[model samples]
Target: MFAGWVQERAGETPVRPRDGRLFVAGEGRQYVLLTYTLKKSAFSLGAQNAVLPLLAQASNAARASVPSAEVIQAGVVLHAAAAGQQASREVHTIGVGSMIGIILLTWLTFRTFKPIGLIVLAIAIGFLGALSVCWLLFGRIHLLTLVFGASLIGVAQDYGIYFLCNRLRADPQMDSAQLLRRLLPGLGFTLLAAVIGYMGLALTPFPGLRHMAVFSAPGLVFAWLTVVCWFPALIGAQTLKAGPIARGYKSLVARWPRLTNQPLTLVLVAVLGGVTVLGCSRLTVNDDIRSLQSSPPQLVRDQIKLSKLLDAPSPVQYYLVRGATSEEVLQREEALKRRLDPLIAQKHIAGYQALSNWVPSARTQAERLALIDARLLAKDGPLSMLAGEIGEDAGWAAVTAAHLRANAAPLELEAFMRTSASEPWRHLWLGKTEGVYASIVALRGMRYPSIPVLGQAAEGLSGVQWVDKVGGISSVLGRYRAYMGWVVLGAYVVVFPVLFPRYRGRTWRVLAPTAAASALTLALLGFTGHSLQLFHVLALMLLLGVGVDYGIFMQEEHERGSDAPWLAVGLSAASTILSFGLLGSSGTPALQAFGLTMLTGTALVWLGAPCFIVTKEEPNASPVLA
Candidate 1:
């Protein structure tokens, strides 16, 4: 077919058979590429989950059919399926463990399951409301959003824990509503601060982060509302006692560093400053998307082998050609083909495939037909001369008739598309999109291909574009990382003013611990050789909200002479650490980054919150804080 098409150029037969074959190394070796077209609905999670097993079965069957042949499966669907499964597994395992730990901790501290019930109820309502809102707004929630949302188990329950802690310390005669009224200032500020922090996530252009922000902010709001509105009624005044565990926690709180002495404050600041400076100095950033979600090692190996064996270009990189009409699109693709030819010869790339390779332009078809007429079909051409020489008039007449028919009919892309031969390459012909005819020119087996060289190939050509998915996403990640850093700083700046009127001189105390914790977390990540990514910055955004809650709880409880604010703060910190710390073990690099940041940042906030407490010299001040 290839030889025949070479002789008869500008036909569909030559190009359709060998689509996306960027390179063919040896004459003896034969390769057949298989392409699958999925239904539009197959992209949804449920559909993808259903399709994955079938794909696996097909892969196994193909491998079994020919032991020597490699059947490597790849596509966006497969990648999404694997990532979804991984995320589900991560969320399930970590979520269950965190829940169990939180339950046991609550039970141990209070010696009752009532607080556990209330905490669980709050989280459930929060998560359900968030999911409902997400479904209403976006139609479908993303797996990443849920993964981050799982951390809300730690965060959303904080309001309840603080209420329960204050309840434990409340006067026996004090009603639930009275206790709630007393705690409202701290809890309300924490909620507002948290919302502000998450709003920063929503501000970013990154879809994943925005989804997470949307999921989280609503979850927090609902959780806080449940505690504020429902908890007083559900959690009516009950006899409560501080268990041994709670007493021990209180003892630890009693000894918390006040940082009130001038020398002590200076020394602590110097140490933190030195660590921050040194650690930040070592900080580096890596925004490559490959670092986020990694395929299984075996799958990675198979994909690499498949790409090398097939000399296939990066699936995510291609040229999109556009024109007013199909003919123009084909012409533009042909022009791109001309530019790529020299690069192929120079070994810059292995090869490329375009729609024009299979379906020639109308002009090209006419030219080829003209050549056929001159060479064979004309009266004095080869067919007539051969018939005159050999005197086989009937056969010569039949051959002449066939050539005339070939010249009379030109194969259009539309007609060729209806044939079975066009199935594999049909996707390349994007008939019309956004009022313009378009098609793709796929490249493969590029050797150290730079943006400059590849981009320049389409520079002089109109309606041609170089689209690099990986590069574009990585660039977006980097840009947003910078934006998120400022957003974090902005959250603090913005929240400080809101907090100032209420706390007045103590506003800095409420905000300072989180700022220090964020800096320290970044420094620690840098010192530990972890390159900062967008997700790390995102974690810091969450830290700003959660860490401030701890400071507010400590400051408010200190002012009110509560028995032990640290009990609630410590429990909140522990549960948060339990939830997010487990994320450090995640297979997804982004989740792992987030988990580590939260783990370190939350712990620092817990410790630092006590240091910033403004102590009073009067006897009315809580003796525990002395």
Candidate 2:
């Protein structure tokens, strides 16, 4: 009776009997439900009614029909229940492990109680500042923003180390205020410049880069404040002395004068550059978003089960489509599906789900409803008898009115709608605020490309955009590569010339060390089979800034013939490298990139510093110099 009522209300035809089978109008396949007379199974009628609408919607939205619905029988419910439990267990495990790893790493890195407390406080302030700015600008912090902000540990530690190092090296007779006055200007200006460089990322078109820029920019200022203000006071009160400085650094710097002037050093720089260029050329950008999946165990297992059960492809691949109207959208999607059919058959694509298959058009729905009416309401039909003694014309009118009323409830017809109004579905739509509609057909389990391939099959369709396999980590990495190139070119154009405006001759000497350090870092990265990512590029830029500091320190130290400048350079480079080089051991790829760059760059800059030192005797030399 309920089925008959639903058929009447939905304007669906009653099932037709053919070869001892009943099939409803517009149904793609037929099914039978058999009930044995000897057995009476207990089930709640109210519960069944509660679930019927959801079942109906799923059936209507199903891309293919069940060949034999009775094949499930009763055990299907048990199997589904078991799968849900298994998925839940897996998710719990992965989430727990990930949390533990984050906490352990954080505790291990910030072991020094006093410095760690100050660093944590600074990070908190910086995070709040970043959160406020991101909230005001974008209205909410994206998931990527949190990840990028957490990764700022390597960059933020620089401030603390610089402050602590200066405090250790200060004359015991000098007060805390005097020590701060000496270090603050250099640390403050350098950090300000670094913040500017990071903030410049906001100019990029990519959302991830913009989020990173917003998060890191404010963090820099807060970190600087903690180091210059809070950190110095803490160190002064404690009367901290320099613990054993790395004696290896002094040995390393002792050879710098000879290494800088060597013919082999220039040759090594050129060779390193050549190697870097070749290796970098071979490196490809990976845009696969799946690379970021640190998915909880249960989600991964559930995904695997879903893929097996439905023979569905991975949702990693995406097809970008744009059109002016619903018809154009459907037509384009239909056209793309036809092109994709061969790929599907070849297992290039497992399966595609799209709105074009379900609705087709509003005109199509209206025509299907008309056909359903004729098929169900023939003379002496079960539905006709159920309509309660009405004349044929009156019965038809009553049925049509019911159908029209059902259709009027937009939410009821949601399954029939071309696009869903749900959040997950909204992600697939790329509509503008002005009502221009667009959709992406995501694909899964595509073959990984080792080399570039091009063609019509490769190029899905003309007039429609095809993102294909480019929207994940590879895309982010590619943007970073482009940004790095721009930074390198821009820094040379802007920074190098500004440093030595009066003397072009001196500029080459400064650039030589920076270039050597950059090349050596790139070569080290390449030799290790590590691709230079965005963080590496930023680190390279930072290496240039540090290289300038070293050059200035060495030049000044050599002129004064004092041990203090040498001590400062050694201690400063030591603190910078120790803080950053430790990051090379990080589990995260981004942090590793930062560490490797800093480690190689700092090592080379220290080696290259003495080349900038003036070795010739002064004309009017004091007896101290003589």
Candidate 3:
């Protein structure tokens, strides 16, 4: 029936044999169950293990012969390829749009070739540097690493904006060195805060999170270096006339005193804080890895169709049995198989296959031999009865161990595993690692809670692991979410105390914008009832980076009594929003969560910046700020 279905789908002579070959490839590294594609799915490595070679084979076949049944495309792989192309185009479009927006905005603001050219140059170099570092660290960057980490370009923009904004707002008579002197303190402090926020991600166990941190942190440094070491020389002291953008900034700041210094503003802040608290209390997190991937409807439909037609295993979960030897591993696996028997009978699981069932443990083999001898070869047993019935009692009495053995070959592990006949079981027999042998018991048509129940049934058995690819990755995400929560808290603890000596009385002012942004983010999350995912926490880190940067810049602008720098802050915020705003709209759940959080949080950061405005700069206020 499956073979007919494949032939029907392909409209050809049985495009390929419809057989269960899930574990027959890669010598047991791949899973047979799947529900998503290779690009965004949590089980990407396993999916690629199955699909990538098939694609390569198809390509080679295309070159070698006319198109035939062998050149069939798996639905998931084709969907993944389409998704990849869409993602690349989306990223490219966003990149080009951001660059164009920045160039035009900068051109309009600075009205010079040098600053625009330098900004573009700095951004390009910073991006290249980030890619190079990621290549060195991860060898090959994962799709999510680029999808999430690419936002580093936005972080890098902050430095360029600040430097150029400094140039814009500086004393025209002041030389470039004096301008650098004034800009250095703010830039340095911003970098410090950015690093503290990004490095929080570095502390998490998730590689994608760490890659994002590494990318943004180093990318920021390189971009800053370009502006500091190269910008001023390339673009000499140039004064800019007031344009509509500059006038718009000035007009907005003009109302800052009236709008923010009122008692109503305080009341509003208090109310917002109260609501934010309520929202945070109600927030829930969804750590399921599938929540991050959100498979396309078409791909999902295809998967269901294939599954129904082929009765294919769609096990989102599996089990790993490990022991000191193959025999021991098989024994433990056999124990689980025994446990699974009831579940299969109950229909809690469709079925399961294990290496133990195919190749019983030596002890089991011995037991089977003993049982056969006791039942048939002993006196007055089946063999003697059969011999008497056949009038061959003497022949039966002469039977010995050698004759019963019947030239049976010893079940050696190496030879059995290496043979082509054992291909179906190869994936089940995971090879030894670090002196412990491993194997997987694949369960078909299973989900969570069911696996947990099965796991409970199999409890007390040593080295039996219920590994739900989705659940396992989700648990990792949950753990690291809790972990990064602590890291973020630690940053606040470390940053505040360290900065206490400097901003003694106005310390809260420095933290105000980010606090408001965070509060607003939580409040929005609560109101929207959006289940926070791992990517949401990741997005929070990026928000904090932007929040801190905005907080630092607002302080610098108000304390210096120059609203011109506010233009830079505003533009930088806009760029960050533009980039991540698009990311928030991604089809992939992870990128969407990341982008949505960033867009929402950064908008609030922009709105909250006014609360930190230095309405009345104290005459004795220090210039040491970020």
Candidate 4:
């Protein structure tokens, strides 16, 4: 009875191209589909905002009427909204946690609330500069930029920390100007290195990485300016006595084994070098696009259920048919459907949908009409035989045949498209685009592995193109991952000229820790079976800047014969680890890869930096530290 009622109403204006099959269908039971159109694109925030209200109204109406009927929620808009909400929640949670962790680390490092305010002020200035510039340049900030920005807390604070550490070791008689002049070269060099690494990110065409680069690079510049221009005036002469932790760093650095110690250094290098090489050999790569962005599991399950129930064609993969006219486009689509029929017979494909399925071309419509007239409407045909069986007059058969012939008008594509029947499948008809008519033949039961075989169906066919969004994205990711790896290596070569002029023969001393740490980090990832990704390469670029900061600090302190640089380096590494370690626990795979790389790489840099410290007796110390 319910099916009968649905058929009566649905059949009144059935889904065109195929009639009521798309609206009402079932084997032994019944299923009804109600498609509600939204004003904005489903992925847009406006559409997502409207989804809940629509869902609520739909559920209420369904329950009030049938009570037992299931109101299944499915479609692109619904899943997109759920993914957006989940990502928002994660960003909030991770952002808050990273903030709290950084704040506590800052307080612990200085053991004063005053420096916390100063550091936070500097970080805030940097953030403002980055956000403002990003808005001006890109006109908007991506959520990914914000997600990547959380780690900037650790990086942006380095310049301020270096300035403040210098203050702790400065003479009480020294003014702010004297301190700024002394610290300028090291800070300047550090800024140059960091900018080189971040600018490399901007070179990529990927919008997410480009946004993050724009967000981070300018923020660092503004933060450095805050320290250089303002930090001295605020607290230049406010020197604090070296705390226990500072003294502990001093002791650790003093007792730490130097690479100048001969046999022991060689043994350590040989063992570690062997391990690094082994790990490098085991390195692999993965660039699957699905790992980059994931939807919520419940939404995924709901989508799968809806797809199974409807036997619907995939929206991501399809064939685009193009022609000079609407009729030509329809005729081309009909040809594509014919190519797909054998696959359907072999059970390799389930089914497909196209505009031609409902609105056949004028040529096809005329042929069908001619066949009907010839077979059933002839003078001595089935109509006359039926009339004879019913004992009707001979004139009755002739009258009925005349009525059928008069009513057999061809269904025009334009007339059908304008009707309510075409509302659900309107997306399949691209009546005019770029001076050509195009239409999509959406496919069902397609797999990525079968794409090459399936794509052959369109081969040698004019204006027919196979479109696979997911496959295309995955291929892009793989290409960029390899590109980024080369770019990271190029960053080192690019920074070499800058360091060579300043440090001269000692340049390798400054770059060694970062280079070694990056290699080992990759090796460690390999040993643990973690495939290399674009995120990992991105993190390595960041590590190049940060790890070099450590080496520069150590070398400068050795030159000045000051115990303060190790303390500064320790504090910097701790803060960095605190920020990125939180990211190691992130739900997002890309961020997790980035965080893990930084967490491991930074620790190794801290441990390896002391080996490069040259003492008075080791003036001619070998690069091997022997």
Number of the top TM-score candidate: 4
Q: For candidate 2, lDDT tens digit of each residue in 416-455?
A: 4445324224445565435666776655445545112212
Candidate 4 yields a Cα-based lDDT of: 0.81
In candidate 1, where is summed lDDT lowest over 10 consecutive residues? 8-17
**Reference-based TM-score of each model:** 0.85, 0.58, 0.82, 0.87
Tell me model 3's lDDT, rounded to 2 decimals.
0.70
Q: Candidate 4: where is the Cα deviation over 4 Å?
A: 1-34, 41-50, 53-71, 90-92, 366-409, 447-449, 623-626
Instruction: List model 4 lDDT by residue over 260-301, tens digit each.
Output: 656776788889999999999999988877776666777778
Candidate closer to the true structure by lDDT (higher is better), 2 or 3: 3
lDDT of 2: 0.55
Better of 1 and 2 by TM-score: 1
lDDT of 1 by residue, 520-564 (tens): 999998989999999899889989999999989888866565655
Give every collision pair in model 4. 17-358, 259-625
lDDT string, candidate 3, 1-626, tens digits? 34774443332111122355332122223223323334555235556457667667756976587444222234655566556655666667667767777777777777666666787888888878888897898787666666655566667788888877777777888887777777787788788888877777787776767887777677777888888888767655664554566667877876754225457866776887798888988898888776665656666765665554444454556788899988899889888888888987887877776766557788887897788767767777777777777788556554753487675454766767778857646767779787888988877666555766876866788999877677678888898788777666667777776556655655666776776787678778878889876667766766766777776776666656887567777888888888888787778777887788889888878777765655454534433221
lDDT of each: 0.82, 0.55, 0.70, 0.81
Whichever of 3 and 4 has more TM-score, that candidate is 4
Worst ten in a row by lDDT for model 4: 9-18
**Candidate with maximal lDDT:** 1
